[model samples]
Target: MGGEKMLRIVMFPWLAFGHLIPYLHLSNKLAEKGHKITLLLPNKARLQLEPLNFHPSLITFHSITVPPLETLTLPPGTETTADISLNQHGELSISMDRTRPEVESILSTQKPDLVFYDMAHWIPDIASKLGIKSVSYNSVCAISMSHVRPSVLPKAAATSQVALSSSSYVGSVPQWSRNDHNSSVYFGDEITLLERSIISLSSADAIAIRTCREIEGVYCDRVAATFNKPVLVTSHALPDLELQLSPLETRWADWLARFGPRSVIFCCLGSQHVLDAAQLQELALGLEMTGLPFLMAVKPPVGYASLKELLPEGYNDRVSGRGVVHGGWVQQQQILAHPSLGCFVTHCGSSSMWEGLVSETQLVLLPQLPDQTLNAKLMADELKVGVKVERQQNGWVSKQGLCEAINRVMDEDSDISHVVRKNHAKYTSMLISPDFITGYIDNFIKDLQALIS
Candidate 1:
């Protein structure tokens, strides 16, 4: 073991924690194999992710200061997607791209064996210049990568943005590419989101997807065909089941303790999935109609200054005992693990999708983004593990549709409920098995080594 070679790897993930956390999970596994890792992220995120660093000595966090936005300066510490709304994402992208010099400085000094990254497509150029191989790690599912090419929304989405109405369309696919980018005032002739991904994947030395054949073999094959590169699977880079659980907040603990086993609904739309005021109230009313105790955590919707102001009139008084609606982020892992939680309504982001599959709760998916839409289809249509809320032609998900999806999974007497429950349980048991994870990760390490060899 001592005589064998050790790899030096650098990790450069996207700005979102959803992306960073999974990259870090991959780092933990690589470090366990005696590999050295340098994790590059925004300066502000370093302290928040410090606790998850299992091997402080082998894996180091290197902060990269994002450049200031040319037109609009963000608050002093706005360093990531979580720091801004969805439409303002383009500004952040400009800042990230401007960090090329800093990243180049870091990469040249380190000269690691491999560079792993997702966004910031120009990484391959830097890696080639430094004589280091680069790998484009897929944080989203292969289905999304294959079928849905993420594109930049109109620049109007930035300034002219308003509350999403019942008639508003957030449908992922055709609409993204359907629009003409010929006349846009965005980062002023900057690359589109889809273009960035394409450039990154096409230019990278290797592709490492955080997925397994069992769940997405066909889609993975499609991705490989599209990119004409071998796609390595890291077994979904699922969070380590053995890691110690973070303590839940006492207020949340005490309130959740009041409910019976598997009797509460937990709905979280991730940190960045914003809904409008009416949408939020409708979702709350849907849960209320379920006549079940619930916990909902969400980001502030457009046009809402605060959660208190965003709520429907009589919302607090009406759903007093049954609902706990929070406006900001929450420890979803802790909440999902609670005994009283039976159902999870999610936005079907990659992390939440994996978490819901592994947890004991049945799923109700309301996917908003493109990647999320495909992920929801995979879970509900392909895996039969959950039910997706029905959307109208205008891409609106009504309160009734949401309530029905939840009831389909939560009603013990319903045959549909039993069917999905059995499938979800069966997959959950297999996915979490220690041997299953080890086999995939072991193969993944060999593949990683192969790339360098």
Candidate 2:
């Protein structure tokens, strides 16, 4: 313990931005703890992160060259953010496989005290063989992790044992269920990777989650018990971004101002899940019918024209000033923290949901595939902090239903909004801070120190 000095940590994230963002934030928090951080990603992903220009001395980005593989011939007119099949990029496995040696070199050279890895291309095995300690970091909630376990959910008739069930929603893996739809319905590749993670991490060191214990305390405990590993539930409380409001950004300001004091509806489906044409039209009609001052961050679907064409009649004209449509990513934390943000219509991604919850903003859940559904169920049912939109067989959200759901959330009549806001505020305040997470890193380093001592 005497020789335990400054710690060095390495992070490897999956290719997608959704997977990268949380790991990047975790790297930031760890760096503040005086640990040297090397974040490894594919070349394109590294380029995407360059603009953030994080602290240089403490943190550095390394690009893994991808081996040339067959191009993923996506559907014509398919948006990159659309809900494509997980196996759509099976060809890219070559690239990931090629990255093994480069990453191994980084580990051998740095000899970091510990490695923190995203549930990406199963690199923890590489880390384990190198004799480096590693932890699996999932951006989703514990419920999702619980589902990824190699067990099927309990029988529908076993009501009493439902909470303890480890039934898989979409597969043979067993997991717990929150609703009737909790059957075999998750990402097969992600499940495979996660199960590999569970096995690889069993003897490694510790498992850290980017969630608060309060929000998913019971589930987190269950996960720790099942995996037989020490678990850390870090909150999503990031340092405040120093942003000043500008009126000349007329679109964002005008839309936000309409929600004056708690009237605006902020809608986003996250970066990965963009709605198709019909779903977009339904959402537009719903927002127009509610007449609520709304700001929708529409990441225009693959085949859709402009946002205006996708909405119901007059949705464009009436909501122009009252509502703003952003086709790309916006500064989400800033928007959530805004005083004018009255309600959130989100896809229930764990990070986005946690941010909204902490900001004391109400939520409207329109979840897509994978762990999102589980997270939404927890938000809407277990926590009583959001509303879920029902879907049809083709997965189309009805316009009238969307309108009704939004109206119910915005209406002062229903106590759901108040309850959601109240609960969100409570969770936000209770979230574990960055310093607390650094403490965990500190402790993990101490254990490593004894080895090299």
Give candidates' CA RMSD values in order.
Answer: 6.7, 6.6
Error of 2 at 45 (Å): 2.8
Residue 37, candidate 2: alpha-carbon lDDT:
80
RMSD of 2: 6.6
Model 2 scores a TM of 0.80
- Model 1 C-alpha lDDT per residue in residues 324-437, reported as the tens digit of each score: 888877878778888899999999999898889889998999987767888998998899999999998877777898899999899989998988999999998988887887
* lDDT tens digits by residue: candidate 2, 1-453: 244487677887655677677777767666655668888876666766765535668888987775543355444422211224334433233345456678888888887767776534345556666767666666768887765443332333121211111123223333332212433333222233333334433433566777766568888887787666677665663544552222224556555655568777888887665677777777876777777777788777767656765666766777776767667667676777678887788888887777777675678888876678888999889888778887877778886777777776777667876776666666666553445545555554554454434
Overall lDDT per candidate, in order of appearance: 0.79, 0.63
Q: How many pairs of residues collide in model 2?
A: 21
How many collisions between residues are there in candidate 1? 0
